[model samples]
Target: MLITFKSKSSPEVTMYQEHAERILDVLNKNHTRGVITAAEAAHALQLLEQEVALSKLHPEVDAAHANHSHAHHLQDEDETAEMADKNHIGFAQRAYPLLEMLRAARDGGDNIVWGI
Candidate 1:
């Protein structure tokens, strides 16, 4: 299944369900239909940014992803190819689009919502 994130400040960010759930996990948010209120957006943005940075510096840190890579083949062919050819699409890459949305929401003080 696909999950889409929306906010007044950013374009829609659509990702696989597993990917979106993982992002929500990283944000310490419930992985259900929900919203990150304007008041909470800044903190959520910070948390995700921190997790992304950590994943970039320590690729081995995301061990859960190793067991959860069943969806790897289902992702974009270009992305899969890029991962094989060069950079591994670790948590950092997977979380980038949502991170951008978080950043936008944080700056604009807009609520970020998903599963609507």
Candidate 2:
């Protein structure tokens, strides 16, 4: 299933459940659908935007992600793709627009809602 994240301050962003769950997990939130307060959204947005810089400051984050991605020992093409998907590089690239939307929502004091 797909999840549609909506905020009155910006255009909506719809992503597959897997992608959404990964993003949510990065924010240290439960992998479930619900409303996110403006404050929470702001905090998450900051982290998402600073992913690269923060990765430098906190090597453990990158290490954990690396370890998780490499845990799959399969050498098949699909497994390779899965590893790539779990990597922060591609996630950061794809998350730009989602972060922008969250920023607008935060600035506007609007909550974000999904799974509706």
Candidate 3:
């Protein structure tokens, strides 16, 4: 499944469900249909920014977290080594589009909704 964020303030942004769910987790939102009203945009942005800041402060944790669920499935040396590679997408990267939308929404008093 895909999560398509709609906002009058910015272009639509689409993300994979997995990545979106992770973002929703960080935002303290349900991993389902929801909206971030203009009124709540600031707080949402702050939460996301804080998480991004924390991720930057602890890059290792970010990488580990991005792959945490998949790590347990590493059944071979090569797989484990591959998991160690620093190529996984971090929270910041995944959150960028939505973050931009949030910024625009916050500025324009627009609402962002997904799964509708």
Which prediction has the highest lDDT against the true structure? 3
lDDT of 1 by residue, 12-69 (tens): 9988887788788877777768899989988888898888888778766564363346
- Alpha-carbon TM-score of each model against the true structure: 0.78, 0.66, 0.87
lDDT (Cα, tens digit) per residue for candidate 3, span 1-116: 88899999999999989888877987777777899999999999999999889988998897777667567777875676586674677888889999999999999999999988
**Model 2 segments more than 4 A misplaced:** 52-75, 78-89
Please give the lDDT score at residue 113 for candidate 1.
88
| Strongest candidate by TM-score | 3
Clashing pairs in 3: none
List per-prediction Cα lDDT, in the order shown: 0.77, 0.72, 0.86
- Which regions of candidate 3 are displaced past 4 Å? 69-77, 83-86
Candidate 3 achieves a global lDDT of: 0.86
| Per-residue lDDT of model 2, residues 63-100, tens digit only | 55545555565568666656655664545555777888
- Over 4 Å off, model 1: 63-67, 71-87
Q: Is candidate 1 or candidate 2 better by TM-score?
A: 1
